[model samples]
Target: MKAAVLREVRTPLQIEDVQINKPGPHEVLIRTAAAGVCHSDLHFIEGSYPHPLPAVLGHESAGVVEQVGSEVRTVKPGDHVITCLSAFCGHCEFCLTGHMSLCVSPETKRGQDDEPRLTSKKGPMMQYLNLSSFAEQMLIHEHACVAIRKDMPLDRAALIGCGVMTGVGAAMHTSNVRPGDTVAVIGCGGVGLAAINGAAIAGAGRIIAIDMAPGKENMVKAFGATDFICAATSADVVKEVIEMTKGGVQHSFEAIGLSKTAEQAFNMLRRGGTANIIGMIPVGQTITLMGAAFLGEKRIQGSLMGSNRFPVDMPRLVDFYMSGKLHLDDMISRRIKLEDVNDAFTEMKTGAVARSVIVFDA
Candidate 1:
């Protein structure tokens, strides 16, 4: 199978003929259909997040199940599924407690002594985030993917695997934004736009979209942002948001994962409001908040994978997309082949494309 392999940090992904192993007892082999190039993938490429080298880097994807392990029962060989990184051990404490996203049991992955699921002519290559959909095929734990309706487009379903789920789940589940509430989302990328869309779906009275790009305002507005704020022109984003909302918004979301933007998200919240940080901030960065900010009951919290239970939430997201309530078609900027993964990352760094999907041939 051909895969885009990251040989080094701050380098281009090399397209190589990699070898994928057959499914183990609890595993499934999926024929990659579509994979979304997300900012999270760029983060690893740019060294914002560190990982083992010679890894296949892609997580947001949807595909058809070509084969399943003997123990796999949730999906059959012909099922279409969306892959998720949060592969949980069903018996873990986190899973039992209904926080499957946080499940980190060793049972979810093969033991160190076991043969690697992926390998190359050089040797075994580490799989990125359990599901390396950049390849022509992916061998992953059955729990890492959820079977979805066959009617859903693989390109759009790929978005729900990560960005859509993260953004929409952050608004709907984490912050619990309600009708008549006001929401301010920092960053107008794919995830940010989805956050705005989610807020709209949740019936937020006012949705504010913030970004440094002036070109994104119209598209952001179309995604349910009632107001737009260009952060590049504003010297103080918190003040502008407060003034825009006639005080501050009831809820604020930070999707850019920057220290400044995270702080601004907190500062842009009204008294007794909540701020949810959805971006994957780099390690060793500390965000200092005002000591008195908590006095007014303004809380700042982190959201992981939209606090998702993929099996339940992903299908609903598919339904939402099918119902025309979710705007995924506009979110896709372009579709490229696996060989163009390097250029896709370059476009991601430029902040020009909302999403660049890698469509694989069956």
Candidate 2:
């Protein structure tokens, strides 16, 4: 199988013929259908986040089950599924307490003594974030993916695997945006737009979408943003948001993963409001805040994979899409083949599109 391999950081991914192993007990092998080129993958590509080298790069994806391990019962051959990075071990404290996204158990992965799931002509290869959907196929733990309705298109379903899940989950689960609340999302990229849409679905009375590009206002508004602010043109984004809301919003989301924006998200919150950071800020970067802000009970917290419980959330999200409530059709900017993955990353850096999907041959 051909896959995009990242051999080094701050370098282009190399397309190579990699070998995928068969499913072990509790594992599932899926034929790659579509994979989204998300900003999170760019984090690893640019060394903003670190990962083992010579690993496959893509993660946000959906596919069909080609084969299942002996013990796998959640899905079977021909089932359509979406892959998630937050694979959980069911008995972990986090999972037992309804926080499956927090689980980091090694039980979901092969032990050190076990043979690697992938390899190359050169040597052993690493399976990235459990799924590694950049390739023609994936061998992953059954827990890492959940079966979705077959009527749902795999390309759009791919977006739900990560970017959609993170944005929507942040608004609905992490912060619990109630009806009639005000929300300001910092960034209008795939995740940011989804946050706005999620906030609307949660019945937010007003949703403010912020971005550096003025051109994104129209696109952002279509996704349920009641207002749009160009951060680049504004003198002070936080002040502008506060002024527009007459004080401050009840919830603010930082989707750009910048320390400055994270702080702004905190500063733009009303008293006792919550700020959710959905972006993966680069390692070693620090966010500083005012000490006195705590007096008003303003709280800022990090959100992982939108605090998702994929087995339940994903299927419902599919239902939302099928019902025409989730605006997924407009989110896909373009579709390209596997070999064009590099160009997709280039486009992502420019923020020219909401999402670029890698469609695999059937």
lDDT of each: 0.92, 0.94
Q: Which candidate ranks first by TM-score, i.e. highest?
A: 2
Per-residue error for 251 in candidate 1, Å, reads 1.3
lDDT of 1 at 35: 98
> Candidate 1's C-alpha lDDT?
0.92
Over the stretch 67-153, how does candidate 2's per-residue lDDT look in tens digits?
Answer: 999999899999999999999989989999999999999989988899889999999899889889999999999999999988999
lDDT of 1 by residue, 1-362 (tens): 99999999988889999999989999999999999998999889889899999899999999999999999998999899999999998987899999898898888788899999999999999999989889999999999999999999999999999999999989999999999999999998889989999999999999999999989999998999999888889888899999988889989999988998898999998999999999988977878899898999999999988889999999999999999999999999999999998888888878778999999987
In angstroms, how far off is 162's CA in candidate 2?
0.1
Clashing residue pairs in candidate 1 (N, C-alpha, C atoms within 3 angstroms): none
Report the error of model 2 at residue 285, Å: 0.7
RMSD of each: 0.9, 0.7
Candidate 1 local lDDT, residue 55: 97
